[model samples]
Target chain A: MKKVHILNYGLGNVFSLYNAIKYKHGNVNLLNKKQNFNDVEILFIPGVGSFNQAMNILNRDFKKLLIHLNSNKIKIVGICLGHHLLFTEGDEGGACSGLGLINGKIKLLKKRNSSDVLPNIGWREIKLKSPKLSIFKKYDKHKFYFCHSYFSKLKYSNQSVFSSSYCHNEFSCMVYDENIFGLQFHPEKSREIGLELINDIIRY
Target chain B: MIQRIIGRIDIKNEFVIKGINFEGLRKIGDPIEIAQKFYEYKLDEIFIYDAVASLYGRNSLFELIKKITKEIFIPVCLSGGIRSLKDIERALLSGADKVGLNSAIVKNPKLLKKASKVFGLSNIVATIEAKKKTDTYWEIYINNGRDQTGISLIDWINKVQDYGCGEIILSSIDRDGTLKGFDLDLINFVSKRSKINVPLILSGGCSNYNDIINLKKKHKSVSCAIASALHYNKINKKDFLKR
Candidate 1:
């Protein structure tokens, strides 16, 4: 059984992700402060609130601890705003610094045509560029529920597994560079396929 | 784009209840059980409304919503008597993914702006209960469809979107709980007139699969919320998915 630590930083609905892991029968714990990172086999950062507000709540010591945890070779999975937090910076709520776990910056999903709504709130299919990757093989060409206005634009590489093109722009939906993974969609809210993928990630 | 099938549960005093035309309420079962059942049926979303939250001057769906979110993995939308920013905070803390506002937003349209600013646009949903008044006009109703606000459906839609509501859930009070089918004319009229780019969810009077599919076909952007038809087992997931 993998030991999971879910960071509840007073932003977003952490319990949804908490229950998601619990539903998969994974051993999960909620880490609220900087000191609770011990024995964390899998570090999960889940978020759904404003980026600037979330960044404000993450204390300086905790930010340092995140880097320390990453250096310890702990597998980290970021969901939604959690995924945005891994970037070098974010423009939501008037620009804020992110955790800088990944080499990317967050930008608002540009409203291209009249049909594209801001905050892209609905289910969208992810076009997998690397279909052979075991971590995302099941979700290749499958739709996942997304509810965010901002997305990350990283330097494209073979490490980027999936992408969703919307509003005349494209953003990375699944980014994996070594042991770290970030998902822009809410797998817990995405029904069965999402749950299955989450289970596989936890066990992997 | 894939349209969603939303299972709506109306609760009165912690019991899941349903009524016709927003009257003659009858308890169906526990909200937790019904919500779990909806999840089992693979409904895309679950909408929970406290049918009489305003009448009692409080929100009674907090614990019910918390319990539902623990077991159900899908998004749960909570509405009814949501007045202040604190109410939105409490509901979100209690596990509601999105907070739906009705009487509260109607009373003070500014509430929409404030809530959206704090909770972000995507987390705030404005639920409009519109009753058909004439051939081309539908008036918005508040307080569980009992009180008429004399506000035109189009006007309310425009206002809420300006206030930054992420989604507009349009419930036809005239067709609610009737199992006759949605008011396609009303939906078509509103969808055409509205300038907002957010998703518009149509609710009330869903009887069969065709009704759901037809709404998707005619209006490519809207989602449908079903209650009576699904509660009574008149329509199932297979019926909606079958081409």
Candidate 2:
């Protein structure tokens, strides 16, 4: 079994991700200030706040550790705001630099019309762009819970495993670049399908 | 966008309870058990509101949320007694996806702006417990609908959006637990009057499948939160996804 570690900075709901992993894997640990990634097989960046705020924390605390993890080829998963952080920059909460693991920039989701709401909340379906990818082969057109005002724009379209449409704006909902994976939706909060997806990621 | 069916579990002293117009409470079951059942039913979301948290001046739902989110893998929105940023932080750390504010925001409107900035707008939900004041107007209520704030429903709805709340849970005090069907007039009135661009979660007075269907037919973009109907199994969970 792979050892899973969830980054627990003073932002977002870390416990939900921890509990989700512990429920199935039972070998999850929260990577806090005193922790090191020496034994971590999988590192999860669980976040639910503004990109600039989260980026500031990551830049201050985990920059070197993240570089080390990336170079070591350790599997890294980013959820929601954490997914936004995988890009080169984000416009949320003013412009800020990200981890730059993937080539992209995060921008506010444009409204298609007056009726479209900001911070698109609730469940929506994802269209699998790379259905041949093993992790997402069975999840085409599956609805996952999404709650964010911003969306990711990747430089390389091939990095996006799944794309979803919201407010008439098509954005990457799931992306994978080598060992780094990013999900704009909260899989931990997406019920059975989400749980199965998490398990699949862990197994992969 | 899909019309979501949310299970609303009203908690009073750690026990899931239901009532008419937010009064005459009757205990239903444990919060954990009720939340687990909702998750099993594959409801789009779970709303856990501590009925007495604001009146008592402390939130007791944190521990309950910790236990519920441990196994339930669905989004959980918690309300009642969220007064400060610290309270919001504690709720999120305990595994809540969103924190709903009612009485606290009524006391300090700026807190909504501050909380939304610190926690991100989507993580903050504004809960409006409303009662019909006139044929065309509704008034906002707080402290479990026991106290009234002079703020009009439409005005507050607009202001809440401006203040940066991502979603609104509009509960009708007259229709809550009545099983009479949703306050269609109230929903229509607000929809027409308020400049609301956020996702609205309509609560109260959903008795059967027809009520939900009717609401969905009329309002294509909104979601509904069911309490009495779901708690008593008046409607099948499968029916929620139908249509």
Candidate 3:
């Protein structure tokens, strides 16, 4: 079984993500400020809740820990709000600095037409641009559960950027740069298909 | 947009139960077993309402929810007795993705604003239980349809949206548990008048696949939540897979 560390910043659906990983028989550990990450192989950031509140509670220790992980080239995964927070800054609640792992900003979804709903909640498809990448090698067409108002707007497109879709308009759905990765959908909540993707990533 | 087929579970004292028009309650099955079955059958979401939580002054389903969350992977919404921000916090922390409010929000409307601000708009669901009063109007019922609020259903729908709720679950008290099909007239009225700009989940009735298909054909924007039809096996997994 793969061993992983999940950052528990006092919010988000950490329990669901924890259960999802554990259900796949992965040995999971919840990381807090006082915890050490010497045994951590993969760092999973599950998404939910407010961006500002999550940022406010990060404290100095967790901030340093994440920066240290980034410098060490440790494999990191961010989901939804967690994905957005990988950027340099976020605008949810108010303008706040992020972990600066990605070159972008978080913006709210704008309605192209009046019929579009905010906080787009439901199962939607994410067309993969990099199918050969280990994370998305299994499927051609993928549909995952999404419930968020804000998304990551990549500043530039590189080969590492894997997927994109139009909720209101085009937005980055998945990003992979070296040891860093991000998914804007809830894999843990996406049922069997999602679990397969998660298991693939963990095994890889 | 694909219309979601959701399973609605009403629980009292840990056992899943259902009642006609929200009265004459009786046991149905274990909440955990029913939830796991629904998950395996591929229900879009599961909504657990504690019908007697307020009367007891505590959300007794917290432990039950923690257990369910471990086995079920999809989103779950818990309702009943959520009167304050702390209650909403505890519910979300207890593993519910969304918290549904009815009598508490109807009594203290600002609770909607505070809860939305603290939990974010997407996490709050406003529940409206409506009963037909006349040929053209329905009255809003509270306390699980035991008391009528004398508030026009349309006006209350607008009010909850104005107060900043992200979604509305409009359950018709007249057709609940009857499985005759949804109250079409009531649903059409809300579909036409609601400018809330959130997903609308219509509950109560829904006996078969045709009822859901007809609802989708008529109201493309709304989703249906079935209880008795799903609980009694009136509708099967194949029916949902056909769509």
Best-fitting candidate, measured by lDDT?
Answer: 2
Name the lDDT of candidate 1: 0.83
Q: Is the docking of candidate 2 incorrect, acceptable, medium or high quality?
A: high
Candidate 3 ranges beyond 4 A from true positions: A59-61, A132-135, A159-168
TM-scores of all models? 0.93, 0.97, 0.93
Local lDDT at B82 for model 3: 85
lDDT of 3 by residue, B1-243 (tens): 656778999999888999998899989999999999888778888899998876677778878889998878898999988888878777776778889999898888999988877677888999889999887788998878888888999899888888887788999999999888998989877667666577888999888888988998988768889989988998888766644
Model 3 chain A is weakest, by summed lDDT over 10 consecutive residues, at: A159-168
Tens digit of per-residue lDDT, candidate 2, span A1-204:
898899987667888888888877788888886566789899999887788889888878887788889999899999999899999999986788899999999999988788778788888999988765875789998888898889999999998999998877899999998899999999998877888888889888
Q: lDDT per residue, candidate 3, A1-204, as tens digits?
A: 557888987655677788888888558888887788777788898755677777776645587778778888888889887787788889988899988888888888887766666667777777766655755755446678877778788876663344545444677778877878888888888887887777777766
For model 2, residues B63-142, the per-residue Cα lDDT tens digits are 88998898898889999999999999999999999999999999999999999988889999999999998987799999
Candidate RMSDs in order: 2.2, 1.3, 2.1
State the lDDT at A118 in candidate 3.
Answer: 66
Candidate 2, position A106, lDDT: 96
lDDT of 1 by residue, A122-181 (tens): 778898877557766767888778888888988655657899977667778988877888
> TM-score of chain A for each candidate?
0.92, 0.97, 0.91
Task: Give the higher-TM-score candidate: 2 or 3.
Answer: 2
